[model samples]
Target: MGDIEPGALVLRRAEPADRTALAGTDPIAAAGDPTRRASIRRWCEQGLALLAEDSRGPVGYGVLEYTFFEQGFLTLLTVVPGARRQGVATRLLTAVEAACTTPKLFTSTNVSNQPMQQLLLKSGWRPAGLVHGLDEGDPELFYLCPSENLSLSSTLRTFPDTVIGKESRI
Candidate 1:
């Protein structure tokens, strides 16, 4: 889940026009759960949403914010079950790290989500601390990556003049 070889993934800043398409296909938004949709919408308002699309369409997504944590925080990352292990998550993460302009980036995963923990470790994110009572028997596992270690090319190959939206070597 951590080592992703970027392929046809097209990274783009999410726009309002994407809401319908996203809500219709994105698992969280399509869950028919008003709460999740509202939460995602709220994050969108802050312009923290990034959508990962391929020839087929949206395969993964991530949201970044500073309100929850003083540092750059990846609030949410979702990859369709079918897209798992294909480096989509890693690419999404690399995009997050590249777009982040803060001194550090922080994120958390439920204790039960072992895959995410593995991904965090493999991606060079270190365990910062933990928060209890966040989920039953599953205290949140916090991870942080200092700016010095936040190298986007380490995870995804990119051109010297590359920017978001352009394809990068896998």
Candidate 2:
């Protein structure tokens, strides 16, 4: 496939026809979590799953779920392995945020998932809070859109210092 700009990606609700291609096949999910396929399927069935495609095909996806406090939660975002590092996740996130009805969108990633955290941070998602005990050692870090204009040096202050490791900080 030719190199397509990330901004050129088209976003749409996932279709039933895309299920086999996505779930039946070994589609990549954030943090390489295998359970995501099932969740993606469930979201698609609810018409909350979004697909991002380029000229090649579906390169990434995101789920705009409302299970969390009835807010638009970016429950899952995945970029196929071949499409990683190409801004696919960013595009997918943008689509999810746009679909949100609130001023801020919510999403979370595991503490160990540095790549996703960095993606969230770079895409203007800010540190909101963290959830513990979901998975030992690695807590789930939450983030939200409409972040303040923070510089690299002042970024640390925006996030709690206690979560340098004990908690999840972005």
Candidate 3:
């Protein structure tokens, strides 16, 4: 467990050992697709796994993986009970966004997950549309921001024009 803030929490990269912490949560594991066990393993192997920790261990975790078509994808994001409304998810997203220099980014959440939708919108990611049946019977909501607009390189830090599902050479 890490130190908790007075009214918030801290987010950091998760180690392989943190798997146990993640598996113990309901929303985190339950939100995972039934057939994605192997994909989860792959995400752990290659993607950036992050956790939000407070005085009570990990309360949230998000896995971000590289996509074959897009520059990157937000594979998963879950915040446990007692940690909501503290900006933990936002911090996790911020770290995820800061980790890559991709020209485009993508993430999908179940249509029922309104909090995540709000979080995505608040984080400067605009919704493209709903990706039907991508999450079992749930409609997956898509969000994206172009890398040029997402550059942290000081020079190109300004925003760029971005649209969902748009093709770009870079």
Candidate 4:
């Protein structure tokens, strides 16, 4: 409803107990897509999901996995419509990047998703390439954020010595 202060939000690895709240924020999952729900569960189980929460509840979640040619790939990033443009995606992305285990983290969004492209660019992710036929008309644009580019100071500044569970707050 109101602007959410970035510092007021908590970013941590998603757990089994978080599946329902995480799915509720996802449009597809909320719409009763069983496949999407299953994917969310799998991501959480595999330790590849990050959840963003404020006092209100779960606002966003991200999934990063090494399924893309053995390198890190951000397969999903979902922020509730109400939470969209308030830095939740950025925080989720930064946390995903921090959790990346490979040298290069890659992600792609449909060309029609301009907001995502802008977010990736502003967050220091560079355009890697583009591929057609992924979404029929709208091409998929790939972006990359190399591990070397992730400075230690950026992570420290974002989290500010916060750790909420077995996982350190990102």
Question: Which predicted model would earn the best TM-score?
Answer: 4
Residues 81-101 of candidate 3: C-alpha lDDT, one tens digit per residue: 666787777766766665555
TM-score of each: 0.81, 0.73, 0.73, 0.88
RMSD per model, one decimal: 4.9, 11.5, 8.6, 3.0
Q: Name model 2 segments beyond 4 Å from true.
A: 5-8, 24-37, 147-170
Q: Write the per-residue lDDT of candidate 4 for residues 27-116, one digit (tens) a residue.
A: 999999999999988888877788888889988999988889998899999898888889889878878777775677899999999999
What lDDT would candidate 4 get against the real structure? Answer: 0.81
Q: List, residue by residue over 80-139, the lDDT tens digit for candidate 2.
A: 777788877776676566566544468899999999999988887789999999999999
Rank candidates by TM-score, best first: 4, 1, 2, 3
Task: Give the CA lDDT, 0 to 100, for residue 107 in model 3.
Answer: 89
lDDT for predicted candidate 3 compared with the true structure: 0.64
Model 1 Cα lDDT, one tens digit per residue, 89-140: 8877877787776677899999889999998899889999999998888899
Ranking by lDDT: 4, 1, 2, 3
| Candidate 4, superposed: residue stretches over 4 Å from native | 151-170
lDDT of 2 at 170: 18
